[model samples]
Target: MSSLELCYPQLLNWSCRGLECLHSEAVLLYTLFSSIAVITVALNLLVIISISHFRHLQTPPNLLLLALAISDLLVGLLVMPVESMRIIESCWLLGDIMCSLSFFLSFTLTSASVGIIVLISIDRIVAINYPLQYINVCVCRVCVCVCVCWGCSFLYNGLILKDNFSLRDRHCNGECIVVNNYVSEAVDIVVTFIGPCSVIIVLYTRVFTVVVSQTHSMNSHITAGTGCKVKATKSQRKAAGILGIVILVYLFTFCPYYYPSLAGENNLQVLGIVTWLLYLNSCLNQLMYVFLYPWFKKAIKFIATLKILEQNSSHANML
Candidate 1:
C-alpha cells in the first residue's frame, strides 16, 4: 500500500508518471537542455540577422536560406523551451489546449523546414548544372516558392493533426502524446520523410554528377590550353561541396526519426532523445553557415561589432 501510494499519489487512475530519477540527474538534464535551447536560439538568430540585414547576401540561394533560418529560429524560440520542460518533467503539466497548440506549432515548423530544404536541393541543382539558367531564378519567383512551401506545410500538418488542434484534451491525462490511425501514420511518414528525402537525394545526385563532370572537363581543358575555362568555376564547385555537407548533416539529424515510424511504434517510446536531436538540426544549420561561407563570417563579425549600426552598412560587400 505504501509503495503504491509512493508511485501513485492521490490514487488517480489515469494520470501518467515519469520514471524515477535522482535529483542530480534531473538537474543535469535541465541544465543540458537549457544550454541546447540557448545555443539553438542564438545560432539561428545569427543566420537570420546575417542574411536579412545585408543587401549583398540577397540572392536566390540566400533567400531560400533565409526562409529556412526563420523556420529554425521559431523552432528554437517557440518549440525548444516547452519541449525541454516536457522532457525534464517527463510529463505534461500544461493543460490540454497548450499541448495541442504546442504540437501543432512543432509539426508546422518541422514540415516547413523540410520543405525549404527540398527547394534548396532543387536550387543547388540548377546553380551547379545550369549556371546561366540559374540567374533566371528571380527574387520574386523565389519569394513565391517560399510562400508556397510554408503554405503547404501549414495545410498538410493541419490536416494530419486536425484532431489534436480541436481545443479538446489530447485523449490523455498528464501526457502530450500523438495518436494517429494506421493510414494517417503511414501517410505522415511517406510525406514527411520518405518523399522529401528521396527528392533531396536524387537532386543531390544530379548535382554531384554535374560537379564531377565539370571538374574533370576543367582539368582536361587546363592541361590542353591555359586560356580555356569551363562554365563552372573552381570556387563554385567548392561551394557546392560545402553546401552538400550541410544538407547531409540535416538529413543525418532528421532521418533517425524514421526508425520508430518504420518499426510501427510510438514516437513517444524513443521520442525524448530523438526529438532533441531533431531540434539540434536548427543550430547545426546556422553553424554550418558560419563554417562554410566566408561572407557569412564577415557579416557575423560586422554585426557583432555593431558596425552594422553605421551609415550605409547594408551596401557593404558581403560576398
Candidate 2:
C-alpha cells in the first residue's frame, strides 16, 4: 500500500488508515466545515451579544436563548474543528487524554444545548399560555435553571465516560472512542434524546395550540386603532412558530447520531457521519435565528458597525 493511504506512514502497520478522498473532495469538505464553524460562532455570538448587552432584551425567554447560544457557540468554536479533523484524517492523531477531553466536551455541549432548547420550549409555553403570570418567571430564576442544566451536563457526561479516563483502555494508538457500557449508553440515549425530545415536542405542540387560540381571540377583538395588544399576540405566535421549527430541525439533525443506540449497533463509520450532522445543527441553529428574528439582523448590523461599542448603546430599541 502507498504511504499516502496511512494516516501516519512512518508508523507503518500500526498507523490508522487514512480517509480516501480526492483533492476536490478534500477541499470541498474542508471549506464546508470551516465555513459552517465560522458562521456558527459568528451568528451565535450575535445572539449572545444582542441579548446580553441590551438591557431590555434580557427577558426570561431570551435568557434561555442566550444560554443556548453560548453552548452552540462553543460547539462551533471547540467541537466542530476537532470532529472535522477526525473525519478528514480518519484517525485520532491526538493522544488518549486529548481524545477523552474531546469526547467529554462534545457530550457536555450537546446535552446542554438540548436541555436549553427544552427550557426555551417551556418558557414559550408559559409566556403564551399564562401571560399574566409570565412576569413571575423572573430572569434570576431562568439563570439558576440554566446553571443547573450546565452543571448536570458536565457531571452526567463525566460519570458516563469515567472509564475513558484510563488511557490503557484505549483500543489503539490512533483511535478515539468513548466507551460506555451497554446499560449506560442505553440510559444516555433515553435521557438525552428520548426524554428531552418528547418534552420539547409536547411543549411546542401545546404552545402552538395556545398561540392559535390567542391569534383567533385577537382577530375577534381587533378594532380601529386598538390593535396594539393584538400585535403583541401575533409576535408571540410568530416566536412560537419559529422555535417550533428550531426544535424540529434539532431533532432531524440529532436523530441520526442516536441511530447506533436505536439499532443496538455501534458502527464507527456511521457514528462519524451522524455526529458531524449533529454538530452541523449548531450552525443551522443561528441561521434560523437570522431568518426568523429581525432583532438578530438589527443586532448583527449594530455589532458589525461598532455601534455596540458606544456608551448607552445597550439602550437602543432593538425591538
Candidate 3:
C-alpha cells in the first residue's frame, strides 16, 4: 500500500484515540483553564468599571488603559469560554462560521490591543519630550489613534476571513488555520507580526531616547538650581527603571507568541500560552499604572473611597 493510504488510516486511529483522551481529561483542563479565565475576566472587567466609574481616571493615558481593558475583557468573555469548551470537547463543534468569527475577533482585538500599547508609549514619550506642547497636541489624538488602530485591525483580519471563509470545514479543528492558502498565511505573517512589531519597536526606541534625554536635562537643572542633584538623579533612575520593566514585559510576553507564528508553524499549545500571557498584559497595566504612576494610584484610591462611602450611605438609608 502507498504511504498516503497507510498514513491515512493511522491518522484516523490516532485521532480517535486522542478523542478518547480528550474526553477523559476534558473536565480537568476545563476546570483549571476556566478558573484562570474567570479570574482574568473579572480583573479586566473591574479595570474597565473602575476607570469608567471614576472621573479622575479619565486622563488621556487612562483612556487608553480603559480601551485595553475593554478589549481584554472581550477576549476573556467571548473567546475564552469557547476556547475552554473546545479544550473539553477536543473538536470544533461551533461550525466554520463561528470558527471564522472567533478567529477574526481574536486577531483583530489582539492586534488593536498591541497597537494601543504602542500608542501609549508614544503618548508618554511625546508628553515627556514636549511637556509644554502636551495639552495642545495630546487632546482627542489618542481617541483618533485608537479608532484608526481598531479600524485597520478589523480590516486586516476581515480580509483574511473573506478569503478563507469558504475553505474552512465546520467539522475540522476549532482553531483558525488557513489550510490551503499560502498567500493568506503570508499576509498573516506580514500584517500581524512584522507590521505591528516594527511600529512597537520604533515607538519604544524613540520613547527611551526621549526619556533619557529628559532625565539628563532634569539632572542638569537640579544641579544648577536646587543643589539636589542626588535626589534628581535618583528620580530619573526610578522613572527609567519603570519604563524598562514595562518594555521588557511587553517584549517577553508578546514576541514569543507572534514571532513563532511568523515562522509558519501554528503550534496551538504555544499560541494558547502566549495568548494567556497577553491577556495577563491587560491586567498588568492596572498594576503598572497604579504603582508606577502616582496619578493613577491617586485615582484608584479616590475611587475606592467613593465606593466605600456609597456603600455606607446605602446601608444607612436602608436602616
Candidate 4:
C-alpha cells in the first residue's frame, strides 16, 4: 500500500490506516460537515442576537431559547469542526488530552441542549395553561433554571467521562473513542434520553390538550372583538403545533443515537449517521424558528441590512 494511505508513514506499525485526508471522499465529507457547522453557527447566532438585541423579544421563553442557542452555538463553533476533522482524518492527531477534552466538551454541550429542550417543553405547558401568569413571569427564575441545567450537564458529562481522562485505557495512539460499559451506557440512556424524553412527551401532551380546549372555547364564544381573541388564539395554537413538530423532529434525530446503548454495543458503525443526525438538530431548531416565527424573520432582516447597528436598535418592535 502507498505510504500516503497511512496516517503516519514513518510510524506505520502503530498508526491507523485510512485513505489520504485530502482524498475525494474525505474532502466531500469535510465540505459537507463544514457547511453544516457553518450553518449551525450562523442560525443559532441569529437566535442569540435576536433574543439579546430586541427588548420586546426578551421574554422568559426566549431566554430559554437564548440558552439553547448558546449551547448549540458552542457545538457548531467548537465541536463540529473538531468532529469533522476526526471524520476526515480517521485518526486522533491532536494528542491524548485533546481527545479527552474534545469528547467531554461535545458530550457536555449535547447534554445541555437536551436539558434545555425539556425546559422548553415545560415552558410551553405554562404558556398554554397559564397564559396570564406566563406573560407576567420573571426571566430571573428562568435564568436560574438555565443555570442549573448547564451546571448539571457539566457534572453529568464529567461523571460519564471520568475514566477517559486517564491515558491507560487508550487502545491506540491514533484512535480516539469513548467507551462506556453496559451499565454506564444504561445510566446515560435513562438520565439523558429516557427521563428527559418522558417529561417532554408528557408536557407536550398536556400542552396540546389545553390548546385543543382553548380552541373549542374560543369557537363557541362568538362576540364583538371575538376575532381579536381568535387572533391571539391562532398564534398560540400555531406555536404549540410548531413546537410539537420540533420535539418530534428532535426525537427522530436523537432516537438512533441511543440505539447502540440500548442494544449494548459500543462499536459505532452507526456513528457517522447518528452522530451527525444529532448535530443536525442544532441547526434544525433555528430553521424551524425561521419558518414559523415572523419575529425571527424580521430579526434576520434587521440583522442582514445592518439596521441592527442603528441607535437604540434593541427597542425596535419585533412584534
How well does each candidate superpose onto the true structure, as a TM-score? 0.91, 0.90, 0.77, 0.92
Clashing residue pairs in candidate 4 (N, C-alpha, C atoms within 3 angstroms)? none
RMSD of each candidate relative to the true structure: 2.9, 2.6, 6.4, 2.2
Best by lDDT: 4
Worst 10-residue stretch by lDDT in candidate 1? 1-10
**Which of the predicted structures, 2 or 3, would earn the higher TM-score when compared with the native?**
2
Worst lDDT run of 10 residues, candidate 3, spans 1-10
Give each model's whole-structure lDDT.
0.81, 0.86, 0.65, 0.87
Candidate 3: deviation at residue 280, Å? Answer: 3.9
Q: What are the clash counts of all predictions, listed in order? A: 0, 0, 0, 0
Give stretches of model 4 more than 4 Å off. 1-22, 167-169, 265-269
Error of 1 at 153 (Å): 0.4
Candidate 4 Cα lDDT to native = 0.87
The 10-residue segment of model 2 with minimum total lDDT is: 1-10
Cα lDDT, model 3, residue 216: 77
Error of 4 at 40 (Å): 0.8
Q: Write the per-residue lDDT of candidate 4 for residues 212-278, one digit (tens) a residue.
A: 8888999898788788888988877887898799889889989999887678655644786788899
> Model 2 off-target regions past 4 Å?
1-24, 167-170, 217-229, 265-267
Question: What does the lDDT come to for candidate 1?
Answer: 0.81
Give one digit per residue, the lDDT tens place, for model 1 in 35-56: 8778888888878788888898
